[model samples]
Target: MLSKSQIKVITRLKQKKYRVQDGLFVAEGLKVIKELLDSNLELHQLYTTVSFDGNLDREQRITEAELKKISFLTTPNKALALFKIPASKTIDSDQFVVALDSVRDPGNLGTIIRLCDWFGVKELICTTGTVDCYNPKVIQATMGSITRVNVSYLDLERYLKETRSPVFGAFMDGDIVYKTDLPTIGTLVLGNEANGISPEIEGLVTNRITIPRFGALQAAESLNVATATAILLSEFKRKG
Candidate 1:
């Protein structure tokens, strides 16, 4: 039987303010919860309708009716787990990095994190205005890749200014990424959905690169930020 207080706490975690205050976040589904359990993140509690084999110290078996009440998803998965938000590590300058300038979509941010993992990019830096990586939607979109990638939110402009490696910003008017020689170690900056890179961050970009359109008319205004990130990461890795 789930207690009222437990239900209330789980419901509050859906909001960013409460999540921040508690320093924890909720992950649903068997796969996501298992992946998080295997990773370094500490599990605060696990509430499940089905039997799970891993760490039993904090496990609670709950009924489906109770699960439906606490779940953020329209259709609740068999399980939901609360995991401690790990501390952000210092930005490592040795490897290629990806930075975001106010990208607000949770799905975009999640996909970008997965891309970073797939492409071997070590760290993802996001501006304060960017969507929180811990947002439930973002975590769901990421699947299990969130555990493999390092995401840090900070003042992107200041971080750009201080970075020793060259900074590359994605722009429509910039040199074609395929034609440009990308360095192995540099910061690839991607901007917001509607707006491109902000003026302040753009000023810090050492190089501006673009993915060219192959179609005859070139009618598309811009690539989706996550798609743009995939292409850019491939180019950088290919050249390096």
Candidate 2:
């Protein structure tokens, strides 16, 4: 049974300020909560509607009706957990890493995080303006991979310059992604939703790349940031 104080705490977590203050974030769904337990992130509490065999510090199996009271998910998943957002470490230049340049939209950010985990890209460096890694929407979209990857919000430009690895940028009219040679190491800079790559970052880009478009079909400006990221990651991993 959830205490009145516990209810208050969970309700407060919906806001970013409280999350930051408590140094904890929410992850919903069986997959995410299970993966969170498996990952390095710490599980503060596990609220479930059913019995869970997975390792947990404190597990409360509430009713489906009770779950509706606490869960932020549209359909209360089997489990929901609160975890501490782990601070990401510095980039190891020798290994492949991704850097985000103010990529907004929590879902997009989450998708990118999942991509990083899938590609085995351990380090993700984000500009100061990028969305918070622990945002619920981003966490939701990341499926369960959020636990497997280390996401760091940092001065991307400074890191890029200091690391000076084979920094690559994705642009609309840039070189073909398939045709261009992509280095395994260095930062892959993904820009904001509408504004592609920022002028400041374009200067830092050692390699400019674009996903090849297909047959003549007058469509929207370009692919969504998440889709673009998936393609880019696939190509880089495929090549190197």
Candidate 3:
């Protein structure tokens, strides 16, 4: 059984403002919870439908009825957890970095983070306008990759201007990526879903690259940001 206060706190965590206010974010599903548990992130609480190994002092076994009251998912997963929001770390600019310019979709951001983890990209930078990485949907989409990726939100333009490494921005009309010289140590900027890279950020890009279309019609307007990210990261790793 969950108390009303507990219910209120957990349900409120679905919203970003409340999450920021409480200094905590929610992670649902057994896999997601387990991955987070293995990480250094501090667990504030855990509610589960069944007992499991690694149960902590703060763990609570709750009925499904109670879980539904606080769950953000339509079909609640076996477990849900609240973890203290880790403090932002300094950007690791020396290694390959992936930056986003107002990429608004939660799923895209989440997938990109997982992609970064897959390609061994150490740093992911997002503009303040980008969706919060801690958004529940984003957290769900990331699965476990969120634990390994270091995500930071900052002034992208200033960072690009200050960095000595080459800055590459994705665009429709830019030079084909395969032929372009991609350096291992540099910044790759991905743009919003509907709009490609913004003009202001485009001005700072030392290299402009694109994934060319081979179809006879060339009918498709653009690749999904997440899909484009995967392709670009693959190329960057293979050829950079």
Candidate 4:
């Protein structure tokens, strides 16, 4: 049975402030929830229509109608869970860090986090303006990669100013990334969807690189930030 209070709390988690205030974020679908269950994340609660093997104590079996009431998905998945947001770990500045200059799309940020996990980049730094990593949409898009990436929100400019790493900012007209000598350790900065790197962050970039267009007319203005991230990170790994 879904209590009014439980529904209220779960539905409110869709918003960032409520999530922060409650110290919980929601993950839906059997796959995502199961992956989270296997990770170090602490489970707050689990609502489902069927029982999970060992989590029967925490699981609350609810009807499909009850699930639809609290679910954030278009077609509710078989399960939804609330997990305690883990504390942000201190950024290891010496690592090959990926920085975001206000990338606003939840899907993009989520994909980028997955990319970081794939490429072994341990830390992801985002400006406060960037979407909350714990946003339900972002969490959904991460497909459980969120557990591996250490995402921290702070003043990006101040962090850049203090670091001695070679900052690489993705730009449309910057030098082609293919030819550039890439390093294994440094900060790679990606910017907003509509707006590229912000001017303040751009000033700190020691290397400005771009993925060049190979099409006949070169009509496309730019690669999507997440796609660009995939290409650039691949190049960095290849050259490292």
The candidate 4 region of ten consecutive residues with least summed lDDT is 49-58
Tell me the lDDT of model 4 at 32: 96
Indicate the residue-level lDDT of 49 in model 2: 79
- For candidate 1, lDDT tens digit of each residue in 1-240? 998999999999988999999999999999999989988989999999999995489999999999999998999999999999998898897789999999999999989999998998879999989998889989999998899888999988888888899999999999998889888888999998999899999999999999998877858777899999999998899765
Every candidate's lDDT: 0.91, 0.84, 0.93, 0.93
Residue 89 of model 3: what lDDT? 96
Clashes of 1: 0
lDDT of 3 by residue, 133-187 (tens): 9999999999889889999999999999999999999999889999988899999
> Model 4 over residues 59-172: C-alpha lDDT tens digits?
888999999999999999999999999988999989899999999999999999999999999999999999999998999999899999999999999999999979999998
Point out the worst 10-residue segment of candidate 2 by lDDT.
Answer: 85-94
TM-score for each model: 0.97, 0.92, 0.98, 0.98
| Root-mean-square deviation of every model | 1.1, 1.8, 1.0, 0.9
lDDT of 2 by residue, 184-228 (tens): 777788999989788888898888889878847785668999999
Off by over 4 Å in 1: none
Clash pairs of candidate 2? none
Better of 1 and 4 by lDDT: 4
Q: What TM-score does model 3 achieve against the real structure?
A: 0.98
Clashing pairs in 3: none
Better of 2 and 3 by TM-score: 3
